[model samples]
Target: MTLDFSWAGEKGCVSLFPNPEFHLENVPAGAKSVSLTLTQGVREMGGEELPLPRNGILPAGTFRTFAPCNPGVYQWTAQAKSATGEVLSEARKARYYPSDEVAEHKP
Candidate 1:
């Protein structure tokens, strides 16, 4: 698996085309300084964990990945930088395009 993405941690948000599928094994093995965070907002939105990008990375925070949401506009942010906060000081946005899920009728 090849990691195909421009490491834009110094200018803009990591925006993805309304997608909902990814893999971690595809990320670059040489990845060293990258921070990935996934978040969403909903009416009475709560802690949630939606599908993340393929080989996405995150940091330690009070944020929860257990938020349940419907088909709508969601938001995400990723901060990639150095320890000294030099050279690199930027983030990216994830545009999640949720697909249709078929649920079987329960008797």
Candidate 2:
């Protein structure tokens, strides 16, 4: 599976508000479902799951929006599961900055 963010900055800096959109692609075949989650430490900011289409394929450009309530480092994960109980997952870290903070650093 592959994940892409709508926006990113140096060292994975991201805007805190207007949460970024996650685009997923290249999901492996036989994946019956997929889910996404965002977390900071032990707190889960947002998550959702979707069942794949009848062909058990995730369409290209499938996307979701996750809200990150605070300015801090966060871990985002995407997972795919098959009927046979096999799982595939990916995780990435990002640093979120409040809009004001981002504006202040502008050149």
TM-score of each: 0.33, 0.54
**lDDT (0-100) at residue 53 of candidate 2?**
54
lDDT value for candidate 2? 0.53
- Candidate 2 lDDT over residue span 1-107, tens digit each: 66545334322333333345555677777777767666666767666676755543444335433445446656556677787656865535344443322221111
Cα-based lDDT for every prediction: 0.33, 0.53
Best by TM-score: 2
Q: Residues 49-71, candidate 1: write the lDDT tens digits.
A: 33233346333232433322444
TM-score of 2: 0.54
Candidate 2 C-alpha error for residue 76, in Å: 1.6
Candidate 1's C-alpha runs over 4 A off are: 1-31, 42-64, 85-87, 100-107
